[model samples]
Target: MCDEKQLQTWAKDTLSRREFGAFSGAAALAACTPGEANGTDANTSEASGDVTESSVSFETEDGTMDAFFVHPSGGPSPAVIFWPDIASIREAKRNMARRLAGEGYAVLVVNPYYRDVAGEQFADFAAWIAADGFDAESGFALVAPWREKLDADAIGRDTAAIVEWLDGQDAVDTSRGVGAEGYCMGGPFTVWSTAAVPERVKAAASFHGGGLVRGDDPKSPHNMLDQAQAEYLIAVAQDDDAAAPDDKAAFAEAAEAAGRPAVVEVYEGDHGWTVPDSPAYAQAAAEKAFADKLELYARAL
Candidate 1:
């Protein structure tokens, strides 16, 4: 399996000029309008107007962590904690959160880099990769420090705090349990959520996430599956699977050994396929992953 640091590096440098409607030049516009290209696809559950959205802040051990919270207006719903990719929280993520909440979930999209900076770190992932001219000028410089602080121990602490805040929210139906999902570097955060709060986090999903399986790391996400009582969905990027084909098998075996149900598959898209504003977004593939996440939550949460 690839090293966690190396896997994150690969995603940071991944860029495609393929014609993506959302990422071509209208990322700002797409961030506000999700599911426009595919016309709401089969995955979207309700109209956007039914979703109540807001910008919320909660105190964590590191400091204040600002996040986007959204849910259906009826009452308490099953909760989902979203960990954004390397670009951190942005409009694109809020769009995704709102959509998730529309499907009967109270979603929280957190800024993974809030320890270093608050608010949107980049306009979107494309801007993040383009920063410093894609590594020549300022790319790594901007993200390296924040990345260093996101190891397993730190993730555990933050997961605890996030779970604590969610447990007491009026919009969260605590009896239903919670689900956590992440993309890219945020992937393992889902697994970490299970270990951080086994009783509350009953479902976890990772989409095109990196570093799920690492041979060298004792605290690899797969290694902690036994500690988490949640069922899992690990969606791998096509290129990521090519790089470490054994990771999925390893994860499946570990899950089975731990008596946890896990669905591990390589979706038909690149690393950033699920996010609408990503240059690599593949509508069909992302819709499939979205459906899987909903199914997991429906059954487990």
Candidate 2:
């Protein structure tokens, strides 16, 4: 089990200042550039054994959220909505989207913190998380002000909007249900989105997601799982289990009791192992976890 001090120390070292600066700089460039106007056009061009990339913005409860969408350039394809970690939309997530597109899936990567900033705003966020030590308390503290500005409800609504938008695209297959994947805070947000619109999401995966189970409030987002219909895959870091063992157990039990398809896999890595930008990233573990994720999507979506 990791104490607050130990956790804080790990977070500090894991979220290095140097890496944060590089991410921040890249985010600034993405924010400044204009995204492709027509998602279909981008995908159609890629369908001929090519890869295409574009960006689009959608209306969320908080405000407008922009996303980088990619896929093969031809016709409607299976869709996957990816939710990024707390660091916001970085190169790793974008690359992942393109890779999925190359695999013949239309991928949409949404900026969960869109309400807080216009485009990529990782630099500001990195500074804040760095100051706060990247712990739960600090995480909430950083997002608190954005609560009224962003609201938890925006998660589901924004995700729904993205799904709707994707379905309308010529590059997406609306008849086939979509899949959702998220990391860190985005992980829980993905689960919330899937539950909010069960009919649309066929598969949902959460990687090192925080708040899967509530610690204090009975009416927390974790309580929303009763409405989930999608098959779920949860990947937990060994250290995170130490902080929320009961919550994790309760979630698994709830899934079983509800007769829902769900599986929880513990990876032998730190909390941010799946994130390439994080200091805690474990390449071997991340590769294995990502393989598991792709397999789940293949079978469920």
Candidate 3:
């Protein structure tokens, strides 16, 4: 794992050197026209649109891991397990979970990087990514090589464990099964988790996910469509298609060939549009995406 202090320093220096315009150029191009907020607010009447927030830890192969848990106060809600982007679990993601819970679902947002750190020290993670730059080559060089030390496999396995735990919880309705959603790196992780325990996941969605297909292996996450027991949705950013057109097609084609119920939508936004804290957040796109995701969970779970 990268040293937290060193990562912070690198991030700060990288941000300092880059002009803000350079970082936000794509976002500026994809900005949504102002409008009313369609989703429930985080700070409203507690019962009407409130979600209880707490922390829970579970044992993984690496060790114990911490995660943010959000759910409704009443009986047995359908559960949704969410994974964060490369920055790991942050306030934005926790808020996302709460909003989903407000919509009447129990949500668990886990820290995939929990092998090394605790909750929401994203500035450090962001600094690491910023200094390293967001590219596959750089990711492998700086990030992927550290996977073993952080027990990356535990991310998928622990997700399955959470599903089992949710099944036993009085607050969750295991009969309906669960839904899984992820963004960016969490996107592929979500699919992998579904494959890990398909019997418990009724729906899976990935937004602007990376690494669906691996060059070195033909049986990557993208090829696991045949193994999915749940309905699937893939939201691809317009810009991302330009870079990984082949992988996107492969994912779609594989799903189709397997006769799975899947829908691939190309949204008019940038890669991080679904995340409000991201530089590329497009309110219009995010709202539509969230609604679509909720509908999928409602039908499948």
Which number leads on TM-score? 1
- Distance from true position, residue 92, model 2, in Å? 2.0
Q: Which segments of candidate 1 are over 4 A away from where they belong?
A: 1-48, 134-137
**Clash pairs (backbone) in predicted model 1:** 132-138
Q: List, residue by residue over 1-301, the lDDT tens digit for candidate 1.
A: 2223332254455544232323434654553444422222212334446676666778888888877777887899999999998778766777788778878899988877888887777766656755665443365578889889998888888888888988888989989989999988889989988988998999999998888887757799999988989999999988778888898999999999999999999889877778777666777898899999999999999
Indicate the residue-level lDDT of 41 in model 2: 41
What is the C-alpha local distance difference test score of candidate 3?
A: 0.68
- Per-prediction TM-score: 0.86, 0.79, 0.78
Q: Model 1 clash tally? A: 1
TM-score of structure candidate 3: 0.78
> lDDT tens digits, residues 139-213, model 3?
334545434443235555787677877777777887787899988877777777777788888788889877776
Leading candidate by lDDT: 1
User: Which residue pairs show collisions in model 2?
Assistant: 43-73, 46-73, 47-72, 47-73, 47-74
Candidate 3 regions exceeding 4 Å error are 1-49, 123-153, 215-218
lDDT of 1 at 117: 84
| C-alpha lDDT of residue 206 in model 2 | 85
